[model samples]
Target chain A: MTNELALAALGDPTRRTIFECLSDRPSAVGELAQLLPVSRPAVSQHLKVLKDAGLVVDQKVGNRRIYRLDPNGIGDLRDYLERFWGCALTTFKMKSEQKGQE
Target chain B: MTNELALAALGDPTRRTIFECLSDRPSAVGELAQLLPVSRPAVSQHLKVLKDAGLVVDQKVGNRRIYRLDPNGIGDLRDYLERFWGCALTTFKMKSEQKGQE
Candidate 1:
């Protein structure tokens, strides 16, 4: 479920930029929108997508909501990617074994 | 490029299952289709999606196309997930720094 959400969330280039922007520090939608080419509401929409994807978390800091990366969701993606490597290694070994027979 | 393709390739559950089937060893579309709930043509289509995603490759073996995982594309996914961890740690440190200031 998390993987599905994450893959969908990260499927877009604009959303990826917004998500990556918070990597340095958490920021308000307006602040982030300033750096991005998209409008403020579009950034807000992207934030919602990231939130749904389980890739970001937000908190009310007085009047504005500050967005930050969600470590758990990120961990899930990392684990997903890790499995791909395992698949690769297994495939690699099987090929090597076949080569040995030949 | 590979990340986009890999994400799109893995976005589907049916394709994911078919790709996972080849994790143990390469197999023909018919053999994989037997293990899957989908039809042989469906399996062939899934393999084609995986191939386009750069997630899997195929070779003709005795008139059958044997599909295997592509390691380079997998490495790209692994590297993509690895960046999320970097983002996480950076966000963690920034939060810690803010807490210390407060």
Candidate 2:
């Protein structure tokens, strides 16, 4: 469920940018808003979606909340892709061997 | 461009399902449609989006077109996620060390 949610959460362009920025380092909504074209409230909305998707988590630092990528959620996605990667490689090798046989 | 397009393409549930099926093996539209709830034309439409995103490829096999997941496009997406994984791991180590010092 988290994998599907994470994929849906990242479907939006703004959310992807926010995720990328947070990937670099944690930041508050104001900081993200400053870096992006969108407003602070918009950034907050996107963050909420990411948080709900389990792709992001926030911690209170002083008076502000800092957002960062959740490695666990990312790990789930990575595992999913890794399965496909391995499958593709196996299929490629089999195809090559079959071609050699022919 | 391909990365973003691939992300957007897979963002759709149906397209993701089709991609997953192709991950197992290549199949024609009728074969995919039989396994899916969608119609043959619908499967073709989703395949078109996947192809346009560079996430899927097709070849003429007899009278039918066989579709398969494109390893190159999947590789691009894998590369993108690997970067984030490395960054997250680095941050995790740094934070863990800081906590150890504290």
- TM-score winner: 2
**Cα error of candidate 1 at position B98, Å:** 10
**lDDT by residue (tens digit), candidate 2, A35-65:** 9998999999999999998889999999999
Fnat of every candidate, listed in order: 0.44, 0.47
For candidate 2, write residues B6-42 as lDDT tens digits. Answer: 8888788888889889988899999999999989999
What shift in Å separates residue B97 of candidate 2 from its native position after superposition?
6.1
**What are the interface RMSDs of all the models?**
2.3, 1.8
Expressed as tens digits, the lDDT of each residue in A34-90 for candidate 1 is 999989999999999899888899999999999988877787777776674586676
Runs in model 2 lying further than 4 Å from the true structure: A97-102, B97-102
Q: In candidate 1, how many Å is residue B22 off?
A: 1.7
For model 1, give the interface RMSD: 2.3
